[model samples]
Target: MTSATLGPLLAEARADGRALGAFNVITLEHAQAVAAGAARAGVPAVLQLSQNAVAHHGGELAPLAAALTALAHAAPVPLALHLDHLDDGPLGRRLLREAPEAGFGSVMFDGSALPAEENVAATAAAVAFGREHGLAVEAELGRIGGKPGDAHTPGVRTDPGEAAEFVAATGVAALAVAVGSSHAMTVREAALDQPLIAELRAAVGVPLVLHGSSGVPDEELRAAVRSGMTKINVGTALNVALTGAVRQRLVDEPGLVDPRRYLADGRTAMTETVARLLAVLHGAAPAVPSARALPADGISPRPR
Candidate 1:
């Protein structure tokens, strides 16, 4: 864990003019691949388990969370476990109240589906819960949209002045803003409003987050970081890589029925993609701290 929190790394990224790559973890393979990639890159990484992913595992969190905690402990570079896209109030609240014990260091209280005022209220409550529980919290203000399974409607942009006010009212650690990126994009074609990103960076005090980064091109993602985005969230890109590799592996060896063989290839593919993404986000500079800086038990600083 390297005594790293999302806040300090984000603040450091903002100060250093780089962006941290936050990858979503769906299974043990996903966790291993992400951690392996980050270690290979020698940079700090965020391994996030999303609400949808939790649901896929029968709504149980303990086993997965525990495994990810162990993986973080054993990872060569710093890694943080985060609960991502927690939108449903009941489920989100429950996870906020319970997940700290399961080793979640942070949570994203997504309220983009609600009306603006209602969203702010829900996010404020979540922020309060996070503060009480000693967890770093993030919330989305504007609706970042996409083709399918996305939370918000399209064409909704974040207002800089309102964003500043929202931060004041919610006290969130970071804000995910809509700057032309959409979720579930298969291709890297989303055109971002660099000027708007810059404006939001200037208006908001906390580090800015860019969700659905899998849709953005490497150059555009780099440009977004340059425009002041500190954390970049990517998911679909890794899924694409993993599934593609699995398909290719099966085709190459039709008689191979072993799950481990196929899944190992998928993990390798995902690892390669994650390493590339990290390089794009932060270049070759090492972002992880020395192992000596972290606790011997692999637990880092907790908010209080």
Candidate 2:
């Protein structure tokens, strides 16, 4: 199977008035679960590898990226490989330059914390490189909540006027704007600003992404899609589910020492989480996303 790009999935979801679900991968099991869950849900989705995740894998990108690309190719549903939140440093620059070669279809160049001029200029350069290298670039403007400083308060929201100008200046394929979500939240009580989402959607020509979506409840997430969010990014929720399952498994069997036993259960839990979230993005709550048999080619029938 050929590798899938992020644009087609986002475009299809936009046309159907839904959103694309992008889940972060931490370990090999996490990547496997994403593929299995997307196949189970029978929907196109994205698998993301963040900078932190890379650092966890010994600060290397190639080995894991190749593995992720292989998984994306094997899935019958269209799956995209994304390098999420490339931090600003030498490692970030190296990753940005090697993303296409590493089999990534898209990358997010994070310059959100930089000064206004530097952010604009750096993002523009990344976007230009992306255009030449056949990779979609995502950029963030407003300072979202949960940045580990400033007391985790959302002091700045993406002004519609400013967002329009930023997109024009940077030429990004997608823009992750600040509405009301935060990163790495294990709970699900974050209330998104739907009105702001609609306003930003109207302001920017590119697709808008909602980062830190694990904290959002079902109804709020649905409303976010209705307000014109094209890509909904989820990271912490999968970890929460996996950890809970692994803990339970160990409790059930005290003598279980083999890593595979608990990790298998964790993988299953993550897969279920993926399928459930994909259903939310599809505007179909209470999704019947249980694992099912597929054809020999490992492709599930595409949603109409």
Q: How does each model score on TM-score?
A: 0.90, 0.92
lDDT of 1: 0.83
Model 2 clash pairs?
none
Which residue pairs collide in model 1, if any? none
Please give the lDDT score for candidate 2.
0.85
Best prediction by lDDT: 2
The TM-score that candidate 1 achieves is 0.90
Clash count for each candidate, listed in order shown? 0, 0
Per-residue lDDT tens digits for candidate 1, residues 93-200, read: 677777778888789998877888898899998888888877889998877887345555666788999999999999999999998998877666778899999999
Highest-scoring model, TM-score:
2
What stretches of model 2 exceed 4 Å from their correct place? 150-152, 287-304
